[model samples]
Target: MLSFTPYENPTYFGILAIALLPIVIGLLCKKRFHWYETIISIFFLVLTFGGPKLTQGYALIAYLIYEVVLVWLYTSYRKHKNQTSIFVGAVILAIIPLVIVKLTPAIQNGQQSLIGFLGISYLTFKAVQTIMESRDGVLKAFNPWFFLQFLVFFPTISSGPIDRYRRFKKDYDHVPDTDKYLQLLQKGVHNIFMGFVYKYMLAYLFGTLLLPKLQQQALSAHGLSWSLVGVMYVYSMYLFFDFAGYSLFAVGTSYFMGIETPINFNAPFKSHNIKEFWNRWHMTLSFWFRDYIYMRLVFFFMKHKVFKSPKTTANITYIINMTIMGFWHGVTWYYVTYGILHGIALVVNDWWLRYKKKHQKQIPHNKFTEIFAVFVTFNFVCFTFLLFSGFLNTMLLAK
Candidate 1:
């Protein structure tokens, strides 16, 4: 049976509270590793790894090994001033673990329980992106400790906004006034409550009440799979509230620590287009893709003989970017479908925009169009979420 056991588990909640204590204390002490803003992130990583039961030890061990190697490589690159080569190397290195995990299904399905809860993907990307930015001279270099802190920040570690180094650095560099800290605490507490409400109240409520019926209907082939569609909508909304709410808590918690981590969502459901939806949804991860993947793809394609002009071959770039976005979610066919669906949507949106621009006098500029666009865009996104949440197969095979 489908279950919401994780959310209801008191032991897990207790562990989370305990894990956050050290981070709170560290913040109170104005903890700065190596007197560098970048180094302070290590403390939070430790706390994050300590949250889960079975995987805590393994996470800590992996984190330690990662910290040692990352520090060594970063320091050597900095000392030799080989910034360009080192940056390229960091981006490549970040992919190693992700590649290994994805290619080796055995690792994911292995008996080792620790491997299952390994939320390494989120941390690894954050680390790699920070290092890449540092190498590009876009962000300042900080010692390993600061990097670790950002990587392991407890609230967002399990799921994340995938914050970049430059923004993180800005937060850590500023000393907060007492009033600011108090305000942060107020917001943090409020956000935590709202997170619970969004998570447990709406998302969880709909999920528990409706999702199992879809699963059953899908199994029994008893109906038209309308239940599955309902579940998809619920799942989509559930995911946002649960994830975005958590990110809000992370932002608020970091704020209290005198670190102004960026917000992750901005009314993403209201987006009229796929591109706009991405901008509002998981804002940090989208930016990460823009900076690390999309930009690189654009440059690479532009350099190739087949794609000389981005203006003429914009569709190619759009397809490549969205496909990469799909792959980033996981090594699954469903994820690929989700990506392709969005890619096509983006292309259509772009064409429509151009058409409207070319015929501005004839295009409708009414609120109705805007409202209709929002409704269509939302349902489109919800349809894709079926693939995202792995309900597509469940719906298809249901009796």
Candidate 2:
């Protein structure tokens, strides 16, 4: 069988059409076919992990087994007792594979780790959250079989608008009514078409065509110039269209399958500030970090009295949270720096908002101000994407 990356080409969607046709018809009739859904899932998984990509297939299988068993054991243990250290240990164990996978290239001169595979980071995030929720006594019944399905849900498997366990379970356990299913059909088709425009037409123009010429010009300039500015904006546009396009495909496919996968992008470039941008961009991931990482850190600091001032506690957590997010991109300096910069931006944005609240009469809010905020946020995000793109590192080496 030939392997296909999800949404990589029109041909893959063709095959997906054949596979999903039955599920679509079934849902139309208000009947859910779990077994057939399983079969199609396997079909797509093989189409993704089979053929030349067999190594990733093997890695996925092994990783799933490990996660399934670990979650099972943890859930079993959790039901019997509650202990902080054990829960923490379970969470750590859940993430160790991801940690090793991330660190391998850093230490091995850019060589990949054997345990690494596509979607590993997303899977780790899902697993850790499962363990965390279980610890909080919220996720009482952890069905290993269903949990496995949730983790490997192929639509969002590769890159995600990561859905939570209970949320997915709620959808997976039922078939939408005929009216709702028809609506989903309409949305699914619209999103996929829109994604075609974004990924193929728009992204092809910006990323495949425009970006390379801009990059070459910027590099030739040997430092900052209008060429560099052009590169920044072009790359930023390319990045958003490409990723948002991918997210559309994932979410649209999930809709067809009667699962309402959360969206990743929502006009992030129009955001008025870093905080607003985070709420708009890669929203599922941002919300996950906010809920799991940022909020947890804030609560921990407050509980421990780590800082006397709430503002200080929040400021410190913002840095740590964003830094971790950056490092999650990769162990590289640029990625880490990108995270730190965003963290700083968030802190400053928060402070400014609070100050504005205290001095509402002094700071004018208007249409022009709104436009200015969007422009500033857009440029700042684009600058960070420049660092994120690693083009600067290449340019520095060339210099």
Candidate 3:
């Protein structure tokens, strides 16, 4: 049994193209062939989790059933009773598996959890969001089968741009008109080709070829040097292209399926500040953190008068929210530090903007200033990515 990770290479896209053909034809004719979609989804799911990864396949199935039932019960409870503790407990239960998966490596000398599966974090995000929205009365219905379909939506299944249940259901239940689908097809093809450039060509050059060599040189130096600086910048670009490329493929595939899944990257490097960078980079995830964690924390703080001032409240929330995000990446000092740095950067960015607004006459805003801001933001982000890369851990900690 041959297995492939989603969008791992050109050959994978070739297989995907063939698989997607019938769905394309059906949509072009203003019809949705639901059975055909199901067949291909299962096929790709198997390809992703079968063969050497069969354990993960079983884990995914078990996790899916668990989440489905959890959400169903929560929704049922929410329809009659809305209690904060119950809602919190439900969210915690939904995340327990993901938390274990994250902690297993740290506690077990870097061994992966047996129950961990690809995209578990992403799936948990969707599940928890659904429960929250349902509690708030936004999501009124919970169809187990539809919920399963949304969770297993193969395009963004492995790593997501994280589609919402309501939005996904709208697209899943309707077929686009001919003209609209043609537009989707055009955008889809463009995205896939651009993804080809970003991932296959540029990422391969930077990540597979140059990153190793730079790592070798940087490691040999065993301290701060130009080689390490080279690694920082190169790794930043490689990370951007590689991830943005994968996001493009995910969104593109979603488009092909007539679902307008949100785009994850939007010229993030061109951002003028750390806040703007967050707005552009991995936008879905950032927005998720902003909405579900940061905003909620701020609201809770204000509601309870936890802080004397709004500024202090926001600053503290920024740190905590980002640190949690960092921990979500992994239970490591480096990841936590990365989050803390970004949190500080965001606070500083906010302060600078406020200062500029008050001193608008004294502070000159022009093309030169704009360019300088972009340059500074880009380099600052690259530096943070260096910390996030864990190469420093290898260099300083390894005996």
lDDT scores for all predictions? 0.67, 0.93, 0.93
Top candidate by lDDT: 3
lDDT of 2 by residue, 36-138 (tens): 8888888888988899989888989999999999999999999999998998889889999999999999999999998888899999999999998998899
Model 3 lDDT tens row, 143-244: 988898899999999889998999999999999999999899899989988998999899989999999999899888888889999999999999999999
lDDT of 1 by residue, 1-399 (tens): 111122245454565456455545555565533243233333444443444442654745675466447755775576559655666776677666665655465445633433333456777778777666656656545666556656665546666767766677666665555566667777877766776787777766667776677666665665556666777788887788877766776666565556667778999999987889988999988787778777767776777756766654667766777787787776677888898888788788888888999999988889999999899999999989877987766555552
Which window of ten consecutive residues has the lowest lDDT sum in model 3?
390-399
TM-score for all models, in order of appearance: 0.83, 0.99, 0.98
Off by over 4 Å in 3: none
Q: Residue 218 of candidate 3: its Cα lDDT?
A: 86
Q: Give the TM-score of candidate 3.
A: 0.98
> Under the 3 Å rule for N, CA and C atoms, how many clashes does model 1 have?
16
Error of 2 at 356 (Å): 0.4
Per-residue lDDT value at 397 in model 2: 93
Deviation from native of the Cα of residue 11 in model 1, angstroms = 6.6
